[model samples]
Target: MGIKLLSIKNKFVAKCLLLTSTLALSGCDDWVVMSPFGDIAKQEAFLINASTVLMLVIVVPVLLMTVWFAWKYRASNKDATYEPGWHHSATLETVIWTTPLIIILVLSGLTYVATHRLDPYLPISRISEDKPLPDNVDTLVIEVVALDWKWLFIYPEYNIATVNEIAAPIDRPIQFKITSGSVMNSFYIPALAGQIYAMSGMETKMHAVINEKGVFDGFSANYSGHGFSQMHFKFHGVNDEGFDSWVSKVRSLDNQTLNHQGYLKLEEKTTGHPVTYFSTVGDNLYHDILNRCVDANTVCMDKQMHLDKHRAKNAVKHKE
Candidate 1:
């Protein structure tokens, strides 16, 4: 009988442990999947772990002491010490305050150094296990424009464009030049890199790389309009062969003309848009978009600057 009871207790403990481990690994969101981190991403994860542990070092002891004090000073415990004159202890005060202050100082120093060293716009230092980035590996340039409820990705190197789909070669550094067409938006790909803002009429840059081949979720972190929920894209990290195949497949499409009128029509609130390919785009189309002059005869930044100068000159003449 004793042996059977002991076996039951052991099985119960094992099941509890398994359940807790599973829940802890599941993570918060359903869309996020477990994937291996690259060099930079691993550093970010390490910082998070260090901060959490440092905070718990203070938090755990305080919580345990609170419970212990309550239990020891219970009304039923007649032997407990009760000294009304006992108030302040300089030694205890110094310890309680200085410990957290020191922790914060250490954390802040580490964060400051890491922030500048791992700035997303900075060039990557290491590629893999202690391997320096090779000079021959070309950095892929992707131009991203955030529209009302969709995303547009332009590959200038390949002279191709795709809507709601982004593909890149694994183990290659990617440079994203992002801007917004309408309002403010944030681009985030959790498993791959950090988040960066996309503002209208302004370009922001981010550098990231994917070491593993997989499909990751990318979404707009900022709420724009009514259709904000549908503004998402798929990030594909593929091998060289797969990337070549994708480019070829996109190039084979016949209807690749993206004229001014067609582009205007596409800037609407669209959900689940099929991947589009544009074989021929108008010259300086991206520059026009950046300057907010996609429409004909609209004043661009250069023209505005020229107008401001002319106004100042006229005022000077009038004063003279």
Candidate 2:
């Protein structure tokens, strides 16, 4: 009876240790980039893992050999051969330089392939593993305006806009046209894909899609100003029906149209603004913003540039 009780106690202790180990490993899921929810992010995760494993092939062996050689060649061990004058060996020299060069070449090739393959401007070819984007499937276009301390997402197709919130249907590709209202900012959603810069008077593009249905956090990855720390928004991934419902809900809101006048107010320096929806959005609003002319009386940068060029030509013609 005594032996059986001792065995039971040991089993209980083993179970407790197993549970603790499992919990500790599960805590690592907090690394959102490694555990992604979108196809593009998954591809990025693959690249990270591949690169780490490739480097570890050399790193792990070198680290272990360092300790092993130190122990094996200790001064206390008289059996170890002394090589005070044997500094150079043809075989050792070949390996010392050749290994790192080979690794560099391989990594370079991988980086070259990944750079083009993962370019944000390139449209997504596949939605997820084994799922090629069908020709008939439509892509969602989102215009992202990085405001002073908030994010404004405009859905061109739906003619609706939202502040500090965005959403898209799962398994459908999303194309983002991003620009800043003021200074430069980085538009990032970790569970989606890489961060792309948003600059005033310039537009940047990023293509991505969500494979999972959940709420993710979106934020400015770069520090812009005093309110930079509060420049966070919510990104929702839902089904087609849910997306439509969300649009309907926004359309039903009493918020005014997001025109140049409205945008001027939004661009003011403020932080921690709650999600607000606008039923109507100005056409070519994003274009106007990209040109740094979201005000009624201001000339767009493109038009201003053209006028300047024409003026220069006229002045030269007069001289002639």
Candidate 3:
């Protein structure tokens, strides 16, 4: 009777899980991470899948053993062993310890390789698995700034900038130099690459290429503040000609220029921000922001650090 009740409870739990998974799958449009459009994301997805499978090898067996032990050692089971002196078995000890140790080693190796391979700071050299990044195509450099509830992208090559929307040519390598103007945030575009943290007065870098021509979601994955949820941007992967046209359109936005003063105004906290284009961005605007001297009255972090070092040296000389 006890065994029967346990079986019935297990069946109900299994049925509930199946139903939940079915419902979740029903609302899916695309498996953005699992089926990503870029080489970096695709490789990341592979690592994820491999890691999941490795975990399940240990998980499935442990789950099965748990149920087996529960049933085999049940109170009502007359066939169950009841030896008072039996505490440990060499075979059981070896199996339990060896299995997890092997899994850990395998997982550690996978993590080491994946960490270096998918490192955000490491520059990627290929577009896809077989296609190498061409020598003719110059790597597109996009300076990214995480604002209160929006994103700012500055294209130095074209002297153009945009807020909440960005474009790049498909199959061309793109490098991102990311920072935050307000608080710490994460730059994430699932179809392009993994999340890389963006922080104030510091810069992080990422390299990726988009193989498909489509608009993808880009956002801050970090819980920054009250307006964090509104920090979503559109990433456009277009053909070379389309990208040129998009740049031209941004350059055509009259009376839309992003300088130190304009950036200060744009950094204000807001929600549901619309896509904005800037005709021109001031030179070295991103570098100035990185050094933490966007405001005229503020001292740059670099200069401050240098001053501190000089003072320390003078103090040591005086002591001598």
Candidate 4:
């Protein structure tokens, strides 16, 4: 009987080991790649991994100890030591508390350094360990306006613009200065980077570079109005030649110049917006949106600031 029970236990252990190995092997494919860490996207991923591992260092041991203690102290284990009133152990207490403190300190230091070093708004340092970004390589600046249910992408460098679709050259750094037309929203491209908020009358900048050529989906992560569900865009990372060709194709459009009236019409809530091209855009139009003065003679945040200052001065004079 004892031999039979031992044999069954051994078989069960072997089967469990085999199952665990198979799961671990399959998990490799699902494991998120942290390799492409040269960019901001990967940097954020690295931070996440670092914090998670640090936390797990404490969590795993505690879990194992809990299970071990429970089994070892079971009523069936007649040989186990037990003293109900013995709880305090100064040495054990110091070790348990100090070890976690050390882990926290290390984690906090890493987090603090990474937070500043991996700031999304910061420009790319070195493209790769082997190659440095050329000083003459001008950063591509795209002004993004989050509309009700669509995205407006304006490339000031090429003097061309597109709606609901954005294309950029692979391995080239791109900076997005984003703002919303009305309510607050979050700009997210999961395959590229994390989400960044877009608030009305405020411009938020994000830096990212796609190393591989692919089409990634971008959307509003924050819940806005009714049409927010359909608010989506395509991010294409192509070769430099392909990007140039795309620019030329967009430039060749007949009705590229989008006047103020046309812009207002385009800003309305729409669903599954077809890719539209603009050959020409109004001068400093993107700047106008960033300043929250897309409409004519409308009070902007800067103007409001001035008005508040003037009122304060007048109030001080009256008090005197």
Candidate 5:
């Protein structure tokens, strides 16, 4: 029996050591959430770390107390106290209750500040800590459509569209107006900012800026269907000149135009779509998608709601 127990313990210890070594060898760079690139992500990381440390301030002492309690009150310890009338002391109660209350108050204030500062709808005030956004620099607007197992990005400024890829110049603020053609999905580019939802028939807004000049991964953080695992996109942050060159290169494609017809075709459910570009895209395409009118046969949500409201007003007048 002793030998069997020893053998099991040895195997368990070996497995634990192997797992720890594997994690250590991979390096922390793989954990992008802990190592942030953009200002929003960096703030989020700081908040996470701050909360963790705050909680640990209480947790570490309690864990040590537990160990100390076990040894102090052990059966073999002759110095252990025995008090049948042991009720909670005022000092102990105050320490236990007041400590948590103080921590909660601090956390509440921290959360409130962070929430407003990191509101996805709020435009970024500064590109970096030292640089305030200039009044002359325009915020780039990108309309995003989450299709079935794919993504479509439309740049209204240039009247161009792309699938499974998007780009912006470094330190330039971007406003993303997002909606869905099919099921709900989360639009997340971890290197740039946090996740925001894209819902059908309604538009959502997110504002963020990429500080780094590199291609990072963007994907649907929400699971929709079987093809959800393969849904991914690339977010490229380049220099101003490189962005201009990229836009020009896309314009040079010259032939493809994404109108409503093209959109319906692209809306079909498929997986693992490669990067595609459209030289021209129909105006108000995103507005149509937001109103659930990408298909000509479908009635737009706003128009239908307006009609319903008008009818209700007429009925009330007649009743009076």
Candidate 6:
């Protein structure tokens, strides 16, 4: 019997070692979302864990009580109380109602706090719990254009652009002004922040900051087309000096300009496209995309809306 027990222990240890070795070889990509590198993602993870624990507080007790009641009132247990006329217990009713109510109240409060605090539109107030952002810290704005299964990141301040890649300085706040060139898509970087939608003729905002330096994955969470599976990019979180160096490198490699005509060529469907850099972007390129008026003869949506409103007002006046 002792020999059998020793053999079982050895097999368990071998299986544990094998699992550990496999994980070590493959890296931690699977758990990267839960193990966040940014403040917003950390808070989101915390909220998820807290909510799960709060729910389990109710779930575990109910499950245990179910088993306990079944065992205690079993037909074979002769000592069990069996009052046929017994209908209800006030204490049981109160417990069944009150515990869940308390849990719900607590969960509601937690949800309220987490929802507003973690809103992607709201700018981050700090780098982390211990680091507060100063009033004078300028924000880095990266305009994101979701093209046909690819991402275009334009640095308006620096007059540089890159396709299928993005970067931000660590501990510095970053805001993304997102739009799509054609179909709707979702921009998601799991380690940095939550996902936000992007669609043509509309713009969305996402605010986040990377607190650690590493290369993380970014992808379109929404399905766009045949190339959707391959629509992914690399996000590099770097220090201030490294970020500047990266910008300089990107500027040096630029061989093309991303203007209206250039953007039109990019609208074509392709898969597994290589990362490309652009030296310049047209001044009104993003604005045109947002208004669905990139072509020269097309009327901007805002202007068309204004005309429609004016015509409606005139019609109402004539009727009166």
In terms of TM-score, which candidate is strongest?
A: 5
Tens-digit per-residue lDDT, 1-320, candidate 2: 99999999999999999999999899796788999999999999998998898899889989999999999999899999887887678998898889889888888988899899899999998999889998998989999999889999999999999999999999999999999989999999999998999999888999999999999988999999999999999999999999999999999976569888888888889989989999999878888998988887899999999999999999999999
lDDT (Cα) of model 3: 0.92
* Candidate 3 lDDT for residue 315: 100
Tens digits of per-residue lDDT for model 1, 63-107: 999999999999999999999999999999999999999999989
RMSD each, Å: 5.3, 6.6, 2.8, 4.4, 2.2, 4.6
* Poorly placed runs, candidate 4 (over 4 Å): 1-38, 307-320
Candidate 6 displacement at residue 221 in angstroms: 1.5
Which prediction has the highest lDDT against the true structure?
2
What are the clashing pairs of model 2?
none
Number of backbone collisions per candidate = 0, 0, 0, 2, 0, 0
Query: Which runs of model 1 end up more than 4 angstroms from their true locations?
Result: 1-36, 306-320
Better of 3 and 4 by lDDT: 3
Candidate 4 C-alpha error for residue 225, in Å: 2.6
Alpha-carbon runs more than 4 Å astray in model 3: 1-15, 72-85, 318-320
After superposition, the stretches of candidate 5 with alpha carbons farther than 4 Å from their true spots are 1-14, 17-27, 79-85
List TM-score per model, in order.
0.85, 0.88, 0.89, 0.84, 0.92, 0.87
lDDT, candidate 4, 1-320, per-residue tens: 99999999999999999999998899676343444422566767778888899899999999999999999999899999979999799999998999899999999899889878767788877554466777887788999999878889999888888998999887788899999887899998866777899988899998877777777778999999888899988988888999999898999997778766678888887878888999888887877777877788787678888999999999999999
Computed on alpha carbons, the lDDT of every model, listed in order, comes to 0.83, 0.93, 0.92, 0.83, 0.91, 0.91
Write the residue-wise lDDT of candidate 6 on 1-320 in tens digits: 99999999999999999999998868755687679999999989888898899999999988999999999999999999989999999999999899999989999999999989888898888989889998898899999999887998999988888899898999999999999987999999999998999998899999999999999999999999888999999999999999999898887855778898888788788888899888788888888888888888999998999999999999999999
